[model samples]
Target: MTKEITVTINGEEHTHEVESRTLLVHFIREIAELTGTHIGCDTSSCGACTILIDGKSAKSCTILAVQVNGKNVTTVEGLATTEGVHPIQEGFKENHGLHCGFCTSGMMMRCVELLENNPNPTEEEIRWGISGNLCRCTGYNNIVKAVQYAGAKLRGDELPSTEPVFVE
Candidate 1:
Protein backbone atom coordinates (compact mmCIF):
# COMPACT_ATOMS: atom_id res chain seq x y z
CA MET A 1 0.00 0.00 0.00
CA THR A 2 1.09 3.59 -0.55
CA LYS A 3 0.63 6.53 1.74
CA GLU A 4 1.00 10.20 1.16
CA ILE A 5 3.14 11.60 3.91
CA THR A 6 4.33 15.08 4.60
CA VAL A 7 7.65 15.57 6.31
CA THR A 8 9.34 18.87 6.97
CA ILE A 9 12.98 18.56 6.09
CA ASN A 10 15.36 21.39 6.68
CA GLY A 11 12.34 23.63 7.31
CA GLU A 12 10.83 22.65 3.96
CA GLU A 13 7.70 20.57 3.83
CA HIS A 14 7.77 17.70 1.36
CA THR A 15 4.68 15.76 0.50
CA HIS A 16 5.04 12.52 -1.39
CA GLU A 17 3.22 9.29 -2.02
CA VAL A 18 5.43 6.53 -0.74
CA GLU A 19 5.16 2.80 -0.37
CA SER A 20 4.59 1.39 3.06
CA ARG A 21 8.03 -0.18 3.05
CA THR A 22 9.98 2.81 1.74
CA LEU A 23 12.82 3.62 4.04
CA LEU A 24 13.21 7.14 5.36
CA VAL A 25 16.69 7.32 3.92
CA HIS A 26 15.34 6.47 0.49
CA PHE A 27 12.67 9.08 0.86
CA ILE A 28 15.27 11.65 1.77
CA ARG A 29 17.57 10.77 -1.05
CA GLU A 30 15.21 9.69 -3.82
CA ILE A 31 12.12 11.69 -3.09
CA ALA A 32 13.51 14.76 -1.42
CA GLU A 33 16.63 14.76 -3.59
CA LEU A 34 18.88 15.18 -0.58
CA THR A 35 21.84 13.04 -1.50
CA GLY A 36 24.00 14.02 1.45
CA THR A 37 22.42 11.26 3.52
CA HIS A 38 24.38 8.31 2.23
CA ILE A 39 23.21 4.72 2.31
CA GLY A 40 26.16 2.67 3.42
CA CYS A 41 24.31 -0.25 4.93
CA ASP A 42 20.67 -1.05 4.59
CA THR A 43 20.69 -3.20 7.73
CA SER A 44 21.36 -0.22 9.98
CA SER A 45 24.76 -1.55 11.04
CA CYS A 46 26.38 1.49 9.47
CA GLY A 47 25.30 4.98 10.44
CA ALA A 48 25.86 6.51 7.02
CA CYS A 49 22.17 7.25 6.75
CA THR A 50 21.87 8.94 10.12
CA ILE A 51 19.64 11.98 10.38
CA LEU A 52 17.82 14.06 12.97
CA ILE A 53 14.14 13.43 13.47
CA ASP A 54 12.55 16.16 15.52
CA GLY A 55 16.02 17.16 16.67
CA LYS A 56 16.97 13.65 17.81
CA SER A 57 19.54 11.55 15.97
CA ALA A 58 18.10 8.45 14.28
CA LYS A 59 19.12 5.91 11.70
CA SER A 60 17.22 6.74 8.57
CA CYS A 61 17.64 3.29 7.09
CA THR A 62 15.86 1.71 10.05
CA ILE A 63 12.90 4.05 9.86
CA LEU A 64 10.00 4.16 7.42
CA ALA A 65 8.98 7.32 5.70
CA VAL A 66 5.50 6.99 7.15
CA GLN A 67 6.98 6.82 10.61
CA VAL A 68 8.23 10.36 10.20
CA ASN A 69 4.97 11.70 8.85
CA GLY A 70 4.35 15.25 9.96
CA LYS A 71 7.72 15.27 11.70
CA ASN A 72 10.64 17.56 11.12
CA VAL A 73 13.78 16.02 9.71
CA THR A 74 17.24 17.51 9.46
CA THR A 75 19.69 16.09 6.99
CA VAL A 76 23.31 17.17 6.69
CA GLU A 77 22.21 19.76 4.17
CA GLY A 78 20.27 21.51 6.91
CA LEU A 79 23.31 21.97 9.12
CA ALA A 80 24.45 25.12 7.36
CA THR A 81 22.75 28.45 7.00
CA THR A 82 23.27 31.58 4.91
CA GLU A 83 25.34 33.07 7.69
CA GLY A 84 27.92 30.29 7.72
CA VAL A 85 28.60 26.59 8.07
CA HIS A 86 27.52 24.77 11.23
CA PRO A 87 30.25 24.33 13.76
CA ILE A 88 30.19 20.55 13.34
CA GLN A 89 30.87 20.94 9.62
CA GLU A 90 33.62 23.40 10.31
CA GLY A 91 35.06 21.13 12.97
CA PHE A 92 35.22 18.19 10.60
CA LYS A 93 36.84 20.35 7.98
CA GLU A 94 39.34 22.04 10.29
CA ASN A 95 40.16 18.89 12.20
CA HIS A 96 40.30 16.62 9.15
CA GLY A 97 37.69 14.37 10.68
CA LEU A 98 36.80 12.72 7.37
CA HIS A 99 38.82 11.03 4.62
CA CYS A 100 36.70 9.28 1.96
CA GLY A 101 33.75 11.59 2.81
CA PHE A 102 31.15 8.83 2.51
CA CYS A 103 30.63 8.71 6.26
CA THR A 104 31.24 12.38 6.88
CA SER A 105 27.60 13.47 6.57
CA GLY A 106 26.24 10.88 8.95
CA MET A 107 29.12 11.29 11.36
CA MET A 108 28.53 15.00 11.49
CA MET A 109 24.78 14.50 11.99
CA ARG A 110 25.41 12.26 14.95
CA CYS A 111 27.79 14.83 16.38
CA VAL A 112 25.08 17.46 16.13
CA GLU A 113 22.96 15.55 18.63
CA LEU A 114 25.97 14.67 20.74
CA LEU A 115 27.01 18.27 21.16
CA GLU A 116 23.45 19.35 21.79
CA ASN A 117 23.16 16.97 24.72
CA ASN A 118 26.63 17.60 26.09
CA PRO A 119 28.32 20.73 24.91
CA ASN A 120 31.53 19.93 26.79
CA PRO A 121 31.85 16.22 26.28
CA THR A 122 35.21 14.78 27.18
CA GLU A 123 37.20 12.80 24.66
CA GLU A 124 35.99 9.54 26.17
CA GLU A 125 32.42 10.80 26.20
CA ILE A 126 32.67 11.83 22.59
CA ARG A 127 34.02 8.41 21.72
CA TRP A 128 31.17 6.71 23.54
CA GLY A 129 28.65 9.05 22.01
CA ILE A 130 29.66 8.34 18.41
CA SER A 131 30.02 4.61 18.91
CA GLY A 132 26.83 4.07 16.95
CA ASN A 133 28.22 5.88 13.92
CA LEU A 134 31.02 4.13 12.08
CA CYS A 135 33.72 5.78 10.01
CA ARG A 136 36.21 3.74 8.06
CA CYS A 137 38.58 6.67 7.78
CA THR A 138 40.36 9.13 10.05
CA GLY A 139 40.73 6.55 12.88
CA TYR A 140 38.19 8.55 14.99
CA ASN A 141 40.87 10.55 16.85
CA ASN A 142 40.18 13.59 14.72
CA ILE A 143 36.47 12.88 14.78
CA VAL A 144 36.57 13.19 18.56
CA LYS A 145 38.52 16.39 18.26
CA ALA A 146 35.99 17.63 15.73
CA VAL A 147 33.20 17.09 18.18
CA GLN A 148 35.17 18.84 20.91
CA TYR A 149 35.82 21.73 18.58
CA ALA A 150 32.11 21.99 17.83
CA GLY A 151 31.30 21.75 21.53
CA ALA A 152 33.62 24.63 22.26
CA LYS A 153 32.07 26.61 19.45
CA LEU A 154 28.57 25.90 20.69
CA ARG A 155 29.47 26.90 24.26
CA GLY A 156 30.78 30.26 23.03
CA ASP A 157 34.28 29.60 24.33
CA GLU A 158 37.37 30.85 22.62
CA LEU A 159 37.71 29.02 19.34
CA PRO A 160 40.53 26.52 19.07
CA SER A 161 43.28 26.81 16.52
CA THR A 162 42.38 25.33 13.16
CA GLU A 163 46.03 25.08 12.20
CA PRO A 164 47.10 21.67 10.96
CA VAL A 165 49.73 19.83 12.97
CA PHE A 166 52.17 17.58 11.15
CA VAL A 167 53.70 14.67 13.01
CA GLU A 168 57.36 14.08 12.31
Candidate 2:
Protein backbone atom coordinates (compact mmCIF):
# COMPACT_ATOMS: atom_id res chain seq x y z
CA MET A 1 0.00 0.00 0.00
CA THR A 2 1.03 3.57 -0.68
CA LYS A 3 0.41 6.68 1.35
CA GLU A 4 0.28 10.28 0.22
CA ILE A 5 2.67 12.76 1.73
CA THR A 6 3.33 16.44 1.18
CA VAL A 7 6.72 17.76 2.08
CA THR A 8 8.21 21.15 1.44
CA ILE A 9 11.61 20.53 -0.10
CA ASN A 10 14.06 23.37 -0.48
CA GLY A 11 11.12 25.77 -0.25
CA GLU A 12 9.10 23.95 -2.86
CA GLU A 13 6.08 21.91 -1.87
CA HIS A 14 5.82 18.37 -3.24
CA THR A 15 3.03 15.87 -2.80
CA HIS A 16 3.61 12.26 -3.72
CA GLU A 17 2.39 8.77 -3.03
CA VAL A 18 5.08 6.60 -1.53
CA GLU A 19 5.33 3.14 -0.13
CA SER A 20 5.30 2.96 3.64
CA ARG A 21 8.76 1.49 3.51
CA THR A 22 10.22 4.14 1.21
CA LEU A 23 13.19 5.74 2.86
CA LEU A 24 13.27 9.53 3.05
CA VAL A 25 16.65 9.56 1.33
CA HIS A 26 15.21 7.71 -1.65
CA PHE A 27 12.25 10.03 -1.71
CA ILE A 28 14.47 13.07 -1.81
CA ARG A 29 16.73 11.58 -4.47
CA GLU A 30 14.31 9.65 -6.65
CA ILE A 31 11.08 11.60 -6.41
CA ALA A 32 12.31 15.11 -5.76
CA GLU A 33 15.36 14.61 -7.98
CA LEU A 34 17.52 16.35 -5.41
CA THR A 35 20.50 14.07 -5.68
CA GLY A 36 22.85 15.92 -3.37
CA THR A 37 21.67 13.87 -0.38
CA HIS A 38 23.64 10.65 -0.86
CA ILE A 39 22.93 7.15 0.41
CA GLY A 40 26.31 5.84 1.47
CA CYS A 41 25.16 3.51 4.22
CA ASP A 42 21.48 2.68 4.20
CA THR A 43 21.81 1.68 7.86
CA SER A 44 22.61 5.29 8.85
CA SER A 45 26.11 4.46 10.10
CA CYS A 46 27.91 6.52 7.42
CA GLY A 47 25.77 9.68 7.78
CA ALA A 48 26.10 10.35 4.04
CA CYS A 49 22.35 10.59 3.72
CA THR A 50 21.94 13.48 6.13
CA ILE A 51 19.39 16.23 5.52
CA LEU A 52 17.73 18.97 7.50
CA ILE A 53 14.26 17.96 8.53
CA ASP A 54 12.45 20.90 10.07
CA GLY A 55 15.66 22.67 10.91
CA LYS A 56 17.38 19.62 12.43
CA SER A 57 19.98 17.36 10.92
CA ALA A 58 18.70 13.82 10.42
CA LYS A 59 19.92 10.73 8.70
CA SER A 60 17.46 10.45 5.85
CA CYS A 61 18.14 6.76 5.37
CA THR A 62 16.79 6.01 8.82
CA ILE A 63 13.53 7.85 8.20
CA LEU A 64 10.57 6.82 6.13
CA ALA A 65 9.09 9.28 3.66
CA VAL A 66 5.76 9.11 5.44
CA GLN A 67 7.45 10.08 8.66
CA VAL A 68 8.24 13.51 7.27
CA ASN A 69 4.75 14.35 6.14
CA GLY A 70 3.98 18.05 6.37
CA LYS A 71 7.56 18.73 7.39
CA ASN A 72 10.13 20.89 5.67
CA VAL A 73 13.24 19.23 4.32
CA THR A 74 16.37 20.96 3.17
CA THR A 75 18.92 19.27 0.98
CA VAL A 76 22.43 20.46 0.23
CA GLU A 77 21.12 22.07 -2.96
CA GLY A 78 19.04 24.45 -0.85
CA LEU A 79 21.97 25.90 1.04
CA ALA A 80 23.01 28.29 -1.77
CA THR A 81 21.23 31.09 -3.52
CA THR A 82 21.68 33.66 -6.34
CA GLU A 83 23.90 35.84 -4.19
CA GLY A 84 26.68 33.27 -3.63
CA VAL A 85 27.50 29.93 -2.08
CA HIS A 86 26.76 29.35 1.59
CA PRO A 87 29.54 30.10 4.04
CA ILE A 88 29.99 26.43 4.86
CA GLN A 89 30.37 25.62 1.17
CA GLU A 90 32.83 28.46 0.77
CA GLY A 91 34.73 27.20 3.82
CA PHE A 92 34.98 23.76 2.28
CA LYS A 93 36.36 25.21 -0.91
CA GLU A 94 38.69 27.72 0.73
CA ASN A 95 40.00 25.14 3.21
CA HIS A 96 40.18 22.22 0.79
CA GLY A 97 37.77 20.18 2.92
CA LEU A 98 36.60 17.93 0.13
CA HIS A 99 38.19 15.17 -1.92
CA CYS A 100 36.41 12.59 -4.06
CA GLY A 101 33.37 14.59 -2.73
CA PHE A 102 31.01 11.72 -1.99
CA CYS A 103 30.66 12.84 1.62
CA THR A 104 30.81 16.59 1.02
CA SER A 105 27.07 17.17 0.92
CA GLY A 106 26.38 15.34 4.16
CA MET A 107 29.27 17.04 5.87
CA MET A 108 28.00 20.45 4.85
CA MET A 109 24.45 19.71 5.89
CA ARG A 110 25.54 18.39 9.27
CA CYS A 111 27.86 21.34 9.77
CA VAL A 112 25.02 23.69 9.01
CA GLU A 113 23.09 22.46 12.03
CA LEU A 114 26.22 22.44 14.19
CA LEU A 115 27.13 26.03 13.36
CA GLU A 116 23.57 27.15 13.87
CA ASN A 117 23.41 25.82 17.41
CA ASN A 118 26.94 26.75 18.28
CA PRO A 119 28.20 29.54 16.10
CA ASN A 120 31.55 29.47 17.87
CA PRO A 121 32.53 25.91 18.44
CA THR A 122 35.96 24.82 19.56
CA GLU A 123 38.06 22.59 17.31
CA GLU A 124 37.35 19.63 19.56
CA GLU A 125 33.63 20.39 19.57
CA ILE A 126 33.59 20.61 15.81
CA ARG A 127 35.20 17.22 15.55
CA TRP A 128 32.75 15.72 18.02
CA GLY A 129 29.75 17.27 16.31
CA ILE A 130 30.66 15.86 12.93
CA SER A 131 31.88 12.53 14.26
CA GLY A 132 28.96 10.83 12.53
CA ASN A 133 29.85 11.97 9.02
CA LEU A 134 32.70 9.96 7.56
CA CYS A 135 35.09 11.22 4.92
CA ARG A 136 37.63 8.79 3.48
CA CYS A 137 39.93 11.51 2.23
CA THR A 138 41.19 14.81 3.70
CA GLY A 139 41.96 13.31 7.14
CA TYR A 140 39.33 15.53 8.82
CA ASN A 141 41.90 18.25 9.66
CA ASN A 142 40.85 20.33 6.70
CA ILE A 143 37.22 19.53 7.38
CA VAL A 144 37.59 20.81 10.93
CA LYS A 145 39.29 23.91 9.60
CA ALA A 146 36.48 24.30 7.15
CA VAL A 147 33.96 24.32 10.00
CA GLN A 148 36.05 26.84 11.90
CA TYR A 149 36.22 28.99 8.81
CA ALA A 150 32.45 28.83 8.50
CA GLY A 151 31.96 29.68 12.16
CA ALA A 152 34.16 32.72 11.74
CA LYS A 153 32.25 33.80 8.67
CA LEU A 154 28.91 33.30 10.35
CA ARG A 155 30.09 35.27 13.37
CA GLY A 156 31.10 38.24 11.16
CA ASP A 157 34.75 37.91 12.09
CA GLU A 158 37.74 38.37 9.86
CA LEU A 159 38.29 35.30 7.73
CA PRO A 160 41.30 33.14 8.42
CA SER A 161 44.33 34.04 6.35
CA THR A 162 46.03 30.69 6.65
CA GLU A 163 44.93 27.94 4.31
CA PRO A 164 44.38 24.42 5.53
CA VAL A 165 47.02 21.89 4.57
CA PHE A 166 45.66 19.58 1.94
CA VAL A 167 45.98 15.84 2.44
CA GLU A 168 46.21 13.30 -0.35
Candidate 3:
Protein backbone atom coordinates (compact mmCIF):
# COMPACT_ATOMS: atom_id res chain seq x y z
CA MET A 1 0.00 0.00 0.00
CA THR A 2 1.16 3.53 -0.80
CA LYS A 3 0.53 6.55 1.36
CA GLU A 4 0.20 10.05 -0.09
CA ILE A 5 1.98 12.97 1.47
CA THR A 6 2.37 16.63 0.61
CA VAL A 7 5.76 18.32 0.81
CA THR A 8 6.92 21.73 -0.33
CA ILE A 9 10.27 21.41 -2.05
CA ASN A 10 12.33 24.37 -3.09
CA GLY A 11 9.23 26.46 -2.73
CA GLU A 12 7.14 24.19 -4.97
CA GLU A 13 4.31 21.97 -3.79
CA HIS A 14 4.69 18.25 -4.48
CA THR A 15 2.47 15.36 -3.56
CA HIS A 16 3.96 11.88 -3.66
CA GLU A 17 2.63 8.44 -3.03
CA VAL A 18 5.36 6.54 -1.25
CA GLU A 19 5.82 3.46 0.83
CA SER A 20 6.68 3.60 4.49
CA ARG A 21 10.27 2.73 3.72
CA THR A 22 10.79 5.37 1.06
CA LEU A 23 13.53 7.80 1.97
CA LEU A 24 13.43 11.55 1.66
CA VAL A 25 16.64 11.52 -0.38
CA HIS A 26 15.14 9.19 -2.98
CA PHE A 27 12.02 11.31 -3.11
CA ILE A 28 14.03 14.52 -3.44
CA ARG A 29 16.24 13.13 -6.19
CA GLU A 30 13.90 10.79 -7.97
CA ILE A 31 10.42 12.20 -7.42
CA ALA A 32 11.32 15.86 -6.95
CA GLU A 33 14.12 15.73 -9.57
CA LEU A 34 16.44 17.77 -7.37
CA THR A 35 19.65 15.81 -7.55
CA GLY A 36 21.85 18.23 -5.72
CA THR A 37 21.33 16.21 -2.56
CA HIS A 38 23.63 13.20 -2.91
CA ILE A 39 23.36 9.90 -1.08
CA GLY A 40 26.56 8.59 0.47
CA CYS A 41 27.35 6.28 3.36
CA ASP A 42 23.69 5.41 3.81
CA THR A 43 24.45 4.40 7.40
CA SER A 44 24.33 8.09 8.29
CA SER A 45 28.06 8.25 9.08
CA CYS A 46 28.73 10.76 6.34
CA GLY A 47 26.54 13.78 6.10
CA ALA A 48 26.52 13.71 2.33
CA CYS A 49 22.74 13.71 2.21
CA THR A 50 21.88 16.70 4.37
CA ILE A 51 18.94 19.00 3.64
CA LEU A 52 16.91 21.59 5.48
CA ILE A 53 13.63 20.16 6.66
CA ASP A 54 11.45 22.88 8.12
CA GLY A 55 14.49 25.13 8.68
CA LYS A 56 16.57 22.41 10.33
CA SER A 57 19.32 20.30 8.84
CA ALA A 58 18.63 16.60 8.57
CA LYS A 59 20.13 13.56 6.96
CA SER A 60 17.97 12.95 3.94
CA CYS A 61 18.81 9.29 3.57
CA THR A 62 17.85 8.54 7.15
CA ILE A 63 14.40 10.06 6.83
CA LEU A 64 11.45 8.25 5.30
CA ALA A 65 9.49 10.17 2.69
CA VAL A 66 6.15 9.34 4.25
CA GLN A 67 7.32 10.86 7.51
CA VAL A 68 7.43 14.34 6.06
CA ASN A 69 3.90 15.60 5.55
CA GLY A 70 3.14 19.25 4.99
CA LYS A 71 6.78 20.05 5.65
CA ASN A 72 8.97 22.54 3.82
CA VAL A 73 12.18 21.06 2.50
CA THR A 74 15.15 22.98 1.14
CA THR A 75 18.01 21.38 -0.70
CA VAL A 76 21.18 22.80 -2.16
CA GLU A 77 19.33 23.86 -5.32
CA GLY A 78 16.86 25.95 -3.34
CA LEU A 79 19.65 28.01 -1.78
CA ALA A 80 20.17 30.05 -4.94
CA THR A 81 18.02 32.65 -6.59
CA THR A 82 17.64 34.67 -9.86
CA GLU A 83 19.87 37.32 -8.29
CA GLY A 84 22.81 34.90 -8.35
CA VAL A 85 24.18 32.32 -5.92
CA HIS A 86 23.30 32.19 -2.24
CA PRO A 87 25.83 33.69 0.16
CA ILE A 88 26.94 30.27 1.35
CA GLN A 89 27.39 29.13 -2.25
CA GLU A 90 29.36 32.26 -2.97
CA GLY A 91 31.45 31.69 0.16
CA PHE A 92 32.35 28.17 -0.88
CA LYS A 93 33.30 29.38 -4.33
CA GLU A 94 35.33 32.31 -3.07
CA ASN A 95 37.26 30.29 -0.48
CA HIS A 96 38.10 27.45 -2.87
CA GLY A 97 35.99 25.28 -0.53
CA LEU A 98 35.03 22.58 -2.99
CA HIS A 99 37.01 19.90 -4.74
CA CYS A 100 35.45 16.83 -6.33
CA GLY A 101 32.35 18.48 -4.77
CA PHE A 102 30.70 15.41 -3.33
CA CYS A 103 30.21 16.67 0.20
CA THR A 104 29.72 20.30 -0.77
CA SER A 105 25.94 20.37 -0.93
CA GLY A 106 25.56 18.95 2.55
CA MET A 107 28.19 21.30 3.87
CA MET A 108 26.43 24.29 2.37
CA MET A 109 23.08 23.32 3.83
CA ARG A 110 24.64 22.85 7.26
CA CYS A 111 26.26 26.22 7.02
CA VAL A 112 22.96 27.79 6.03
CA GLU A 113 21.18 26.35 9.04
CA LEU A 114 24.11 27.19 11.28
CA LEU A 115 24.02 30.82 10.30
CA GLU A 116 20.28 30.93 10.68
CA ASN A 117 20.81 30.23 14.39
CA ASN A 118 24.28 31.55 15.13
CA PRO A 119 25.36 34.17 12.64
CA ASN A 120 28.80 34.50 14.16
CA PRO A 121 30.49 31.21 14.84
CA THR A 122 33.97 30.72 16.14
CA GLU A 123 36.38 28.58 14.16
CA GLU A 124 36.22 25.83 16.73
CA GLU A 125 32.44 25.97 16.86
CA ILE A 126 32.20 25.87 13.09
CA ARG A 127 34.60 22.96 12.98
CA TRP A 128 32.68 21.08 15.64
CA GLY A 129 29.36 21.80 13.96
CA ILE A 130 30.37 20.24 10.62
CA SER A 131 32.37 17.34 12.01
CA GLY A 132 29.70 14.97 10.74
CA ASN A 133 30.15 15.96 7.12
CA LEU A 134 33.14 14.47 5.34
CA CYS A 135 35.10 15.74 2.37
CA ARG A 136 37.77 13.69 0.65
CA CYS A 137 39.14 16.72 -1.11
CA THR A 138 40.79 20.00 -0.09
CA GLY A 139 41.38 18.75 3.46
CA TYR A 140 38.46 20.91 4.72
CA ASN A 141 40.66 23.98 5.11
CA ASN A 142 38.68 25.72 2.42
CA ILE A 143 35.43 24.37 3.82
CA VAL A 144 36.15 26.09 7.11
CA LYS A 145 37.02 29.23 5.21
CA ALA A 146 33.80 28.91 3.30
CA VAL A 147 31.71 28.69 6.47
CA GLN A 148 33.57 31.68 7.88
CA TYR A 149 32.94 33.54 4.67
CA ALA A 150 29.23 32.83 4.98
CA GLY A 151 29.29 33.78 8.64
CA ALA A 152 30.78 37.09 7.69
CA LYS A 153 28.14 37.53 5.05
CA LEU A 154 25.38 36.84 7.55
CA ARG A 155 26.86 39.43 9.88
CA GLY A 156 26.18 42.07 7.21
CA ASP A 157 29.84 42.86 6.67
CA GLU A 158 32.17 42.68 3.68
CA LEU A 159 32.97 39.05 2.79
CA PRO A 160 36.75 39.21 3.25
CA SER A 161 37.49 39.46 -0.51
CA THR A 162 36.56 36.19 -2.20
CA GLU A 163 37.42 36.54 -5.87
CA PRO A 164 37.20 33.51 -8.13
CA VAL A 165 40.31 33.40 -10.27
CA PHE A 166 41.24 30.19 -12.03
CA VAL A 167 44.85 29.82 -12.95
CA GLU A 168 46.13 27.85 -15.93
Top lDDT model: 2
Q: lDDT for model 3, please.
A: 0.90
Better of 1 and 2 by TM-score: 2
State the TM-score for model 1.
0.96
Candidate 3 local lDDT, 26-94, one digit each (tens): 999999999999998998888999999999999999999988889999999999899889989989988
Candidate 1: lDDT of 38?
96
Q: Hey, what RMSD does candidate 3 come out at?
A: 3.1
Report the lDDT tens digits of candidate 1 across residue range 1-168: 999999999999999999999999999999999999999978888899999999999999999999999999999999999999999999999899989999999999999998889889988899999988888888888888888888899899987776666689
Can you tell me which runs of candidate 2 are displaced by over 4 Å? 165-168
Structural similarity to truth (TM-score) of each candidate: 0.96, 0.96, 0.94
RMSD to the true structure for each prediction, in A, is 1.3, 1.8, 3.1
